[model samples]
Target chain A: MSKAEKTLLNVPKIQADFPILHRKIRGKRLVYLDSAATSQKPRQVIDATTDFYMRYNANVHRAIYELGEEATREYEGAREKVAAFIHARSPNQVIFTKSTTEALNLVAYGYGLKGPIQAGDEIVGTVMEHHSNHVPWHFVRDHKGAVLKYVDIDDEGNLRMEQYDELITKRTKIVTVSMCSNVLGTINPIKEIAKRAHEAGAVCVVDAAQAAPHLPIDVQSLGADFLAFSGHKMLGPTGIGVLYGETEALEATEPLLGGGEMIREVHLGRASWNDIPYRFEGGTPNIAGAIGLGVAVDYLTDLKMEAVRAHEMEVTRYALDEIHRIPGVRTYGPEDVKQKAGVLAFTIDGVHPHDIASILDVEGICVRSGHHCAQPLMERYDLPATARASFYVYNDSDDVDVLMAGIRKVQEVFA
Target chain B: MADLRELYQETILDHSKKPRNFHEIAEADASAVGHNPLCGDRVTVYVRLRDDTIADIAFVGQGCAISKASASLMTDAVKGKSRVQAHQLFQLFHRMVTGKPGDPVNTAGLGKLAVLSGVSEFPVRVKCASLAWHTLEAALESKKEIVSLE
Candidate 1:
């Protein structure tokens, strides 16, 4: 057996670490293929969260009690872990938010609205951005009277890089792009895109919500001024997300919310902002969720992201080959496995995506059926929606086999 | 949990495959579009009203089987009814689909729409079944804004 294939055999053992993977739906074993929406948590991550509440259960960075000290230590410890995970220079660059949506909104409100973006300035984005990434820029555009421009996708779902040459210029103040597409699983060349944006003297913001879960992300290597991702999609608890900004970038941007923890000293009408990361993290943060996310990061670090990516690529390649053999199935994104991640967005002839999802549900197969929060991408393809099956670390070849069977059942029922 | 067979009943499948009155009425007296942004399901409901009664009703759009069947069956059920009667039927259908688990579905006067009572078992699908009916109500009232079951 090949070295990669030999290591991938441990996938079933990895699947056993997740409590929900053992669940049965509709009298059949659950075949969860919707990790792109949100991933199932491992017992380690869940236990870490529960342990925080049960043991510490104290507000962070406020009280002088031992429990509060412990909570604050764990919370700040998580920031260090996140910084290391993304290869950031320091933990002070990381800010915790409720979700990736909130993180992106923070950037839009702080950097785009209050910082450098001005009237008639242009912001560049791609057609494949999630609404979280796309709409915030709209807010910037509407409030600042800035023009919003999009880098379109080609027939095979690849970004038209030539358009970047044409659209991005000195007029562009900010260039935001998703490191990976949520719907098409297109792995963008952010390094190249960021390079181009830098040449034009524009800051590059990356929406790494999809990419962070499956790929190894290095903020410095990608040259992202700001990067955002949610912990929930990467085997961690919900209500906790990370926003990494360079020191210079965070210093230039203002905080979106004002209150305790964000200000150094408040005197009636005047208040000085806190440090780089703390200034952005207003109010009491999701301390337990952050602690859990740190453990989740430790888990990923133990497994190594390269192995995870290789396993997913193998499963996706297998699924793509098998799906093409089915007469009526048309899968989206780049045909080459190397160019794509684990997302399989497909449509069946004469079958609506919702119907396919419903049938798959009967077989205890979980799949996403919707516009995937990328309505612009849907419009570009002239499609209402597509059935998507996304893979993660726990997913194996057996899961793909079950998915194939479920899809065949959908066709049979429709026939 | 309700069986998939119950949700995708033979009649529902048949209607979805070849929806009745699946066309736009020329010079529609009242028309409204319904959108389920969650699943990208869309249906445009058209009504030609004669005084207080519906003289004709047709629809055109793309949606899931549950939504398309719901819209198709809804058009048939309310075709000849008065505006008040159609509104009453909509209320009845809405309650039936949104009712809690094991709650007795008040199917009396619901007729063909009782088939959609299975939707209540699948709570996530409640919006899919109701999108068309909401659009129908918008059409009857001649609401210019598109109806949305967000």
Candidate 2:
């Protein structure tokens, strides 16, 4: 075993922190391997959310009551936690949205559609982007007449650097790419890509929905003008996400929504927007979800993000080795473990992905099957769908054993 | 694993591997495409209706065993039946797979399709078993568009 393999986290202790892991599925122990879709929440995060609703349930940023003050403090405190988690320059840079989809749309519409993007200008993205990052750019292309370009990925699922370099030019107004692909598990060099985009005088947007959970992200070092990630994928509650933008980028982009919380002063005809983050968060926000996410951030911090990444690397390596031993199994993504996260996308020759998923479910294993919301990427690979098994902090080698056993059973059934 | 056997019966597996009437009618008078966006399952149903009587039916697509086998059995079942009879069979098959409460399984007319009665045990897969039937409905209605099961 490698040194990295020896440093794997204490899986039994971490798995115990998640209450859902204790439950049985179909009279069998549940082996969850679908963290990319959404993570199982830890007890600490769940208790924090319940604590908020039970103890201090009040509207924020409006009322002057003591309960209101406490609510606002917790909400704002969560924002600070997110900022520190991502190494954002300031808490104000972290704008809370509903999910990564809404965060990316905010950037696409607030910045790309409103004005900055002109007709015939190019907006570049990778072919491997989830629909959230890809479709919004299509909207910009169709409505604004901005030409959209895609950087292609090789058969190994690595981004072709030459194509990426060729796609970004002086006419490129914005370049949005995922820091880590949800399907292929390929981790791109965000700092290098951001530098290239900056040299071309274009803003770089990082879709960190899959990256934020497994990787340590520093917005300053990454050189990203804007970054978006979801809460549910990182062991937090749903309906809460973060969008980190440089102060100047936030000031330049218009607010996507107009409501009570996002406005400073309103007149009959015109209304001035609030400050950077406040201007973007409209209406009564997801207060409980934010507090829960804050607790999740604290939990991850306690584990140390570096340790989390190392653990995932070890588990992914073990999974890759075990899966390779299975006949007729073909895996996608970077060959090197360092170039990927915890996702393992594969196909069994005779059995369809859905069938594999179904058989796996019978064994109390959860895996995602289908296009993974990246139809364009699926088209590029000429594959209808794939079965994906993703790992998280709580996963270990034992979970991989169950997954392998399930795959072998599927092959036997089909054979 | 026993429940899984019921879902993927030997007949279903055989048909999925080599589905009967699985081809594109180059001169199909009526054809419609059905797509399940969630699983990327797509099936295009083609039919030749002569004097309101089904003369021929065929399908071509890629999907799971359940869906492909379902399509194969559907084409075999509805190839010679009239338009009205095909519609009745579609309704019966839908109810059988969906397991609508109070609606008992009526396999009196359904032949090979009775094997798929176990589909109700897996609720999420009901759509997979019904994709081809839905496309056949669209083709019969003369709808000139893709049918999306969102």
Candidate 3:
């Protein structure tokens, strides 16, 4: 193991941050390996939600009362923390939507023009994006009559940037990809690709949903015109997320959802829209969710993103080394552990993925089974689905041990 | 007490290791494909018939324990039975998998298959346990190339 692998944190304090870890399930400890779906919130974020509800629960913006003013300031302060975390220039560029799904859809619907996306104008994307990225892009393509293209992935799950170079040209309007593949956990080279897209005058959108929790993200450094990520995936509350769009990109788009707050003036004949961030944000925001997300951000900052990534690296390197030892077991993605994130997908020789998942479940080990929302990628590999175990900061070597013992049990059971 | 998990008793494991009638019958009367997308298990079943009676059946594919065991058990269960009798057995086998106890698919006698009844406890594995029967039923209903329960 290298220095990055040895950089694991003194993470004993992490259990205290998440209260639910104290709870028992089926008379045993809960070994949550599904952090890729949603993270368990820290106590601070949970308490923050309770505090907001109990003390100063009021709508943000255009409030005169004391509670409302306090609520507004706190909410805006949360936005600043988010902006700073991602290294954005200002909070004005950050748009708070329900999730990465809604954020990507807002861009697909709002910024897309009919004429620019003529009969054959190309929109280049990759095969590894989550359904949150795939479906919305399809919605735009169908409506605008644009051609959608996919950049091939190598057998190792790395993007074929050379194929991307051939596919992208003056006709390419948008290039969207996942920063970290959810199923394969391959951390993509977004900065280099974003530069490539910019050279061709195409907007770049990065789905940073899986990256935000494990890896430190800097939107400006990545040079993406728009990026989307969900809070729930980052140890925050569900139904809240951050969408970072370049100020110029936001200014060029129309309002996504029409309602009370996202407007300047309305008439019997026509209605004008609000500015960038507010324009995209519709009425009655997820106030409590946002506040909880702010608390989650604080919790992660306190833990240190570098430490989190280090611990994950230690666990992943250990897992990758051990999982292949089983007879007939197969793993997918970049062979270099450093090139991967916390997710590891594999198949056992005699056992199917669902059978593998079921056998693991008996030992109180949780894992995901199936195509993992990348059916096209599955088709590329000629596979139906795979069993995946993903890690986060909360996971430890013990989790990996439980997983190892569980796989051994499967061998014993089938023996 | 029969350990249903031991339905794959030492005997079942032996059968799975060297599956009997695990081939394609060139002069088969009907054939079908079955797939389980969740686990990537796919198999083809071919049935050879003489007149209206069941003659020979074979299967080929890659699968897990439940599917391979079920296929091996199926080849053992259906040889020498007539088409109508095979449908009756297929119906009972279907009910056992789908958890519909009183479906018309049940026949009076399926002794060793009762071990498979324990499989109904695991809903997801039911398809894995019944892939061959579903393909047999599909072959009886339509083209025998591949029938999907996916």
For each candidate in turn, the interface RMSD (Å) is 1.2, 2.0, 4.7
Pairs clashing in candidate 2? none
TM-score of chain B of each: 0.97, 0.94, 0.82
CAPRI grade, predicted model 2: medium
Model 3, residue pairs in steric clash:
B31-B144, B32-B144, B33-B146, B33-B147, B91-B105, B92-B105, B92-B106
If scored against the real structure, what TM-score would every candidate get?
0.97, 0.97, 0.84
User: Per-residue alpha-carbon lDDT of model 2 for A1-415, expressed as tens digits?
Assistant: 4323475577788989999999987778999999999999999999999999999999999989999999999999999999999999899999999999999999999888995889999998999999999888888988899999989999999889888678998899898899999999999999999999999999999999999999998999999999999999999999999999999888889998899899989999999989889999989999999999999999998898999999999989989989988989999898688999999999999788999998898899999999999999999999999999999998888889899999999988888
User: Candidate 3 — which residues are off by over 4 angstroms?
Assistant: A1-7, A23-28, A50-75, A113-116, A324-327, B1-36, B43-63, B71-110, B117-150
Output the lDDT of residue A353, model 1.
94
DockQ of 1: 0.73
Q: lDDT of model 2 at residue A306?
A: 95
Estimate, for each residue in A387-409, the C-alpha lDDT of model 3 and write its tens digit: 89998887877788788887887
Off by over 4 Å in 1: A1-9, B102-106
Model 2 chain A: ten consecutive residues of lowest lDDT: A1-10
Which numbered prediction scores highest in lDDT against the true structure? 2
* Per-model CA lDDT versus the true structure: 0.91, 0.92, 0.81
Which of candidates 2 and 3 reaches a greater TM-score?
2
Q: How do the residues A194-288 of candidate 1 rate in per-residue lDDT, one tens digit apiece?
A: 99989998989999999998999899999999999999999999999999998888888999999999999999899998888899988999999
Q: What is the DockQ of each candidate?
A: 0.73, 0.63, 0.28
